[model samples]
Target: MKKRLLALCATFFVAFSVPAFAQGTVISIEPGDGVQEALQEALILAEPGSVIELAAGRYDFTGPLSLDIANITVRGAGMNETVLSFTNQTTGSEGLLITAGGARIESLAVEDTPGDGIKAKGVDTVTFKDVRVEWTRGPHAENGAYGLYPVESKNVLIDGCVVKGASDAGIYVGQSQQIIVRNSRAELNVAGIEIENSYFADVYDNVATHNTGGILVFDLPNLPQMGGHSVKVFRNTVVANDTPNFAPPGNVVATVPMGTGIMIMANREVEVFENDLSDNASTNILLVAYPRDYNDPTYNPLPRAVYVHDNKHGRAGFAPDKAVKDIIAPITGLPVPQVVWDGAVDGFWSAFFGPDAEDAIYIREPMGTTFANLQMVKDMILPWGASPDFDIDDYDGSVPSREPVSLPQDQ
Candidate 1:
């Protein structure tokens, strides 16, 4: 009888404990003022694939919170109920930095960091959901550079988040591939959302308002990543980006005109469609060539293979900025067409007769929206001036439509 009882107890222990062990570890952090310290220790001690649960409370963190483990999840009670305030942050470039791939950070609010609010670097299969990163002090030049910054990462999904008050861009995705930034809202920043030097990005169903510039798809020079391409911006509300440019002087976004919406600069295979652009003073939508000098030989200065169609615009291009007020408006006059391009290209040969001689800017604006191509000949002379081409029919050629971004192993 004793042997039978011991055997039964052994069987029960194996049945329950084995399954519990296979379910992975759960590190529950107690609610306390030393939340940062406790969380840091948990990160250091927790095994891979562990779930770190943060209780509902305000966690004041001074330094940065980092995750270097793969397949780890840092989840909070809720974005509003559990707060990570960095208002008095003394050290770190970001509120939370995740370097490990296959990690998920969700349901947390990170506020008032000195630099970027949440930055994930070189990570694959990372998901950021229900996260709110904001600057409580409002828009200023000293605000963080980006609210949710992801660079050089692949298979990234940023969903259902709200970000505000970035000196540069509220949601900046750079050099990343297979990125989907959807169901998000950004406001009161320099560039509400920017996809720079990235490929295969799908940005849709987002609200971008009250920013310096609404949405930007740019390819800048001199970086580890160059030549952004294959971007799709659709079904988003990019409106009234009238906030003053608070970006630091040396940054690329500083040159972005205020009250501009959906600026695409020097990228290829871009499609902008089914979006609502309204009340932007400078221009509702701009497709311009990169004017700055670049050292990168592989970088394409002119935007090629871009398709813009079926977008709705409202009352844009009313008040112009300094660049427009000084150069474009002097020749084109006020309400500088809803869509304008510098028409700067590779000499008259390409502009008139070359492989890309066809107007690269394809505008099928169904609302009978007029557009202007400066054509780099204002006052009939060359160099700085341009004769404006205000006919919408001239830019009628269409490029091949690109496929949507495809990623493997997505959640």
Candidate 2:
């Protein structure tokens, strides 16, 4: 009887110990049949601070995956090793939609989504690291809109990510504050890395190449968040962005001219410095006003207090395209200036009152770096031929440097 009881106790101990060991803080998920269901279930049922470990394998998902739980991590073995393929996805928009705060998604590849890849919306303290979102078909109009998209989120950090073949913008952060996007590569997209309608952003150390437009800082009208200001774009390599715009009609990025290096529109207090801009056929840098008509009284259509300094420009503006080819290059001549700014200001009232001292375009560059201010508003009102201003000395002052954006995740 004693021996039998001891044996039973040993069996009980073994049975419970195996389960306890398996049910630890980390939830390991293997890729196989029913992977979608298993991942979705794990995302839904995971407790706070739980780590959902995705093993190194290809996961074939037929629908979108969402995580609504806060303070959970979804980590894969490696970006290239662990693949999440949504090629045949028939439901939902994004490949993965994260709606919860304190979410960290790292080391995974999302491929061939019809809509977007890995979108974090309305969350706080989100981090996307070492992830790759790619459309293997190359740049096409039917490709997804954005890759590594974080919108309406605060304290966002996107680091060491690669996004390719997006129809719209790759590595897009919209309506987010306190954002830092660094060490990323965006290629074969309409706009490589765009900071749209966001405040207090630092975009640096990224490679923006082979896209239609390399980097765009734009503030459009009629968004939940407006008044984009205090953005610093520095230390980026924006080069050879000569891809034709493949964005579908009626998209905002469709208006971006091909071969644009860095375009800024309708934002205030922006600083562009220490970038390597080379081989962009349209222009190295373009500063323009909002081209469309809008009824938003709260919106300011003119870019103000912009500072562009200390950038290395090479072989740009040789072959302009789109509206720049049709209108701007004709006035500014072939091989349009490396820096092109449409001299647009508030209104007719500004002709007499003059622009405020704070709302000025400042450029401090090397001696031979070319520039042109198209005087667009003046020509529209006066119409006495296209009198483009090629003198860079008129705009030679600096604005106060903005403080670097600090995110909680970087710490």
Candidate 3:
């Protein structure tokens, strides 16, 4: 079977054609008996800068596939045409695990993985274009964690992708620098798109809906990277994110209230603007400090230097859920607000001295936009009941604008 597959690949090299600028060999693989062995062998034997082309068909695998050769391009016929089904996978965590630099995986779909659908870890210059990862069973706690996940990598570009039914996040980029996630759609996930503990990322031109949370920019504690900063999220359509949180218990995202459009937690120097947000029943946008107690002295739990401006909002917070419905709704009344900021600072000293000019929340929205500053810190210390500030004018032009993030991949 191996010899026959190799001969078939050679025949394909002669019969098929690649681009004129392709500097490497093209090894083609089609679905048939022993296809899992054929594809895995091709991936192992392929040299650097090779193009492993997969034909249009369903490829069944009982285990995971890994690509470790640098500068390899894995091209499929189309996202819907070439399906890699790991429904019966018995070993390995991810359907496809990529650890090589300069690897591009495009035009394919991975379905029904026990773990992550596709994961790129510790790679430099990786790109995922026109790919889709999904669970056929839809939203459930047993679904995979992430659809297209890139972690601890630099110079990442994820464009024209679709992800659904991820228990955690559909498109997640974490602990990476110089990243861009654009022209994507995510639905039926815990978080549609999440940029966590990353630096210099621009997430724009994406559609996020039907998830527990639409888009999240979070800086969590105790990681290889801390203090995530310099992110710009703009021009995204975030609406109707009313899916109940299906993450496993005790996960951080499990705390996310349903119907959250965009939530920013413990991130600095972030900007949110020009987004179309509507019908997100919890709130259109939430800016909050990290709610858990942490022992990391280096972690800054407050979100600072954040600016939100000129975002269209409609009919949000009308049907709040989870914490938003239980705790916040009683205080703020029905239709909680379009934007809610947990007024939490570092400590008593920072609260008494007032936040620095650069570490304030800035808001510039259209008229009739509702907002609230739930003075959580003040309520914790003082004896008075929650003094929720419902004014938006106090936060006008409070922080300096951030420069746009430019990536090497964009150039």
Candidate 4:
């Protein structure tokens, strides 16, 4: 009797503990399969490392589809085919709120939420691929917060997503690291794509057009971690975004007459390169105030260590002679020759000023000091040369197309 009792206890322990050691299981959800039933079954039976596959249909959650399961993969038919929508979400409610790490929601469309479309909080290894998120609530305050808001998340990849009509921001990834946003389009929103308080991010080959502000990298204040540093915002096409009533209020930066293209604020060790920026209402790119309170615990300074090169912008608001003066010197408060190419200064002097008068700009530092790199000045600001767009050997048809360049990666 004693031996039998001991054996029974061991059997019970094995039966319970075996499930814990096993990997998560896969659960499938289909229209014909009863959506709520499958979801319920998954919630009940799913372990860690589970996958929940959904068929093509519109799923309206009577309540939130909150997944307590960790390391689960949710796959859908496609963005167009499968739709997960919420009509009535109260404050701070998301269409899909992912709290678990290593979770993925791919190839679906989520819309019409009270708060954010998808909010991934404190999760790691999250990926949203080919997903579409929109705030159908018009442009009012009732509109949802962000298309994708990943705060304090890591290794997040938001690729090929069409984010539209968010009252706040289309793609807002804040306080995250190793984030990659590629080939995404953000339109008809307050701010297009915002990567703030992030590091080691690569935002490439995206189109942020016709938003209030297009393609913003900011290290905003009033945050615990306040450095938007070591980012590569390259090869994006930003244009004609500054239609009024869409831009944010109380913004000190005005849209350039042509609209604002790329606005970099208080970020450090950043590189902005090989982008097509034009038709902004005010300026193509604005280097706004950096976060002044990051350096010391009390008072961090704005981002330093910035490199801007080989970008192509329309000549609507920017003139040949004043290109460097207006764009570079004003922000740096440095001399003329410090920013522009050597050829550009020589060419500007030749066309606008005689030899004696041309030399005067160098000596007097009208703004503050002489310009740098006369050749680049000639190439950039000088008139009647090959158009900056077409002159480059790898210039591909005024717009970004399939044609490759020598340094395709550089652009």
Best candidate, TM-score: 3
Q: Give the residue spans of candidate 2 off by over 4 A.
A: 1-24, 349-354, 383-386
Candidate 2, which ten residues in sequence have the lowest lDDT sum? 8-17
In model 3, what are the clashing residue pairs, if there are any? none
lDDT digits (tens) for residues 184-257 of candidate 4: 99886677888888877888899987776678788766676677777778889887665443434443222221
Residue 174 lDDT in model 4? Answer: 91
CA lDDT for candidate 2: 0.89
Clashes of each: 6, 0, 0, 43
lDDT for 247 (candidate 3)? 95
Q: What's the lDDT for all of these models?
A: 0.82, 0.89, 0.89, 0.60
Question: Candidate 3 on 111-206: residue-level lDDT in tens?
Answer: 999999999999998989899999999999999999999999999999999999999999999999988999999999999999999999999999
Cα deviation of 199, candidate 2, in Å = 0.3
Ranking by lDDT: 3, 2, 1, 4
Tell me the lDDT of model 1 at 168: 94
Q: Give residue 238's error in model 1 in angstroms.
A: 0.7
Better of 3 and 4 by TM-score: 3
TM for every model, in the order presented, reads: 0.90, 0.93, 0.95, 0.67
Candidates 2 and 4, the one with greater lDDT = 2
* RMSD values, in order shown: 6.5, 6.1, 1.9, 12.5
List pairs with backbone clashes in candidate 1. Answer: 376-386, 377-386, 377-387, 378-385, 378-386, 378-387
